[model samples]
Target chain A: MAGARRERDIHAATLELLTEVGYDGLTIEGVAARSGVNKTTIYRWWPSKDALLGSAMVEADVLAIRLPDTGSLRGDLESLLRQIAALLTGPDTSPVVTALLGAATHRPELGEVVRRFFADRLGRELPMFERAVRRGELRDGVDPATVMDLLAGAVWVRALLRGQPPRPAYVRETVDLVLRGCTS
Target chain B: MAGARRERDIHAATLELLTEVGYDGLTIEGVAARSGVNKTTIYRWWPSKDALLGSAMVEADVLAIRLPDTGSLRGDLESLLRQIAALLTGPDTSPVVTALLGAATHRPELGEVVRRFFADRLGRELPMFERAVRRGELRDGVDPATVMDLLAGAVWVRALLRGQPPRPAYVRETVDLVLRGCTS
Candidate 1:
């Protein structure tokens, strides 16, 4: 129980540092100072700064998302997208996401984790689209899985690349564009 | 003449390091060692690592793209997507892009440069879609620019996250989905 408490404390300290300093600027020394854990103990649990930061990032709010079921593809997608947009804009998740994305470029291991995190989330939410496909509401040969990637990629590009917030209307239109096709 | 030659050599060395070390592991010291330039000289041209990296990256192949003047929206877009996809997957540009994207996550200054890069690219390309809109090729209320975002974002997501090369077929389907609508 004492060990668990210490671990939680250290993780919390790391998260605090992440928000303050970002991934690139974060240091194990800072984590040690902030958490009151000896640097050796941190090194014992995590091999490198990247590992420690990655572990700390896992403690952030990214994985808590629950899929919504609104009984239709559009409604369900809209809800999921709204939640994602909200998360991207949310204070707790934004910096962590930004940091993780930064880390993933050079660190393929972290990149895999980020990819898996997205895949896992998409796994839960994609059934909504699958349902629509099964009901003949979508076009033939349209990949349900790829749709989520496109949706997410679009929103993330807007958020990360363009510095734009994922507007609710933008989410809706993106969903509509994917499901119904963008044609007249 | 000596100073100009030295500056060019430094930038070239930095570009090489950009590929070898990537954005995260890249350092001024490393650049100096690689370029045979003193650290102060590297810092003299660029104030920080991000700025130096941004300068190096801007000199990479990304600037070579020209918005095609092919007649018709589909033709122009297909050409653009193909060229963009080639640039994205192209060896010289890929590592530079990956590094720039990672840097943008943490460095606001670099982020602005990256944003301007995309805006310039997308800004030029979007008018092609607008011409389509005027020609009634797309539906009412659909912002040609937004559709352009979806298209570009979709391709970028696949490349960035999935590590999958953008297929010509995927580009075809994406263009079709955006322009034709997907509903049966």
Candidate 2:
């Protein structure tokens, strides 16, 4: 039980270091220092610094937050985007995501983690769109997968490149644009 | 004259290495070795590897290709998308963009370079949409910037994450989705 507690302690410290120093600047020594644990303890649990961060990142609140079903695609999407906005603007998580993506250059597992997160989120939200299709709210032959990509990609572009925080209105607009097919 | 010539040779060699080694694996030592230029010269010109690649990326055909004016928004967009497709599918430029974006996680200049590239491209393309608006083809309050981000972001999401290459038809669908607003 103590060992398990210690391992959790190391993961928490790793996430702290990831947000502070970023992926490139994060070192095993730094994690050990921050966590008040021995470097050997960190190494004992994870193969490398990447593995530790990757494992800890999986436990981040960003992944744990469940998507709400607001009974309308528009409502659910707005809520989803608002949640993402909160995550992006919230303390440390933005930089954590940036660091994760940045570190993924060398560590392919990081990319896989990011990919899995997106896929999982998509998986949760996609059924809503599919329900819309079944109800004929969407056009025939509309690929829910493509729509998912577009919707998620829009927010990602703003976050990753524009460095602009997500706006609830922007998410609302995106949901409107995709669902109704953007009528003037 | 010789100094300028040498710089061009070095930049050219950097592109070659960019294609061969990608942005992640590209090192100053590798650039110097491959280009046959001294490492001192590279360090003298560029402060770091990201800086060297940032400049080389700007110099590459990535932004050098011109967007065509087909006298219609649809035609012009198709032309632009084709150019983007060419750039993405062309020799090493897309991967270079990805690599540079990968580096952007750690390096500020690289991120700026990417942002500037998007801004420039978006700046040029926004007017085309505006022209459509003037012709009453689009809504009066449509946000061209948002629209641009959506289209470009979709393409980028594919490039950066999905391991799926951008196709000309994907561009067409993107244009179609956005144009749906304009047409009504």
Among these predictions, the greatest DockQ belongs to: 1
Write one digit per residue (lDDT tens) for candidate 2, span A35-79. 788888678777786667656765544435566777666676677
Give the lowest summed-lDDT range of ten residues in model 1 chain A: A54-63
Poorest stretch of ten by lDDT in candidate 2 chain B: B175-184
- What would the TM-scores of all predictions be? 0.74, 0.72
Q: Residues B81-124, candidate 1: write the lDDT tens digits.
A: 77767776788777767777777787777677676666766766
- TM-score (C-alpha, index-matched) for candidate 1: 0.74
Clashes of 2: 0
Worst 10 residues of 1 chain B by lDDT: B54-63
Per-model tally of clashing residue pairs: 6, 0
Model 1 C-alpha lDDT per residue in residues A2-23, reported as the tens digit of each score: 2877877877788778778866
Please, what is the whole-model Cα lDDT of each candidate in the order they appear? 0.72, 0.67
Model 2, B1-184: lDDT tens digits are: 1277677777777777765676667788998887788998789889787677767655554446575767777777667766765665555566555565667776666677667666666777777776777666666556776766666667766655654677877778777766662111
Best of the candidates, lDDT: 1
The local lDDT score (0 to 100) that residue B130 gets in candidate 2 is 67
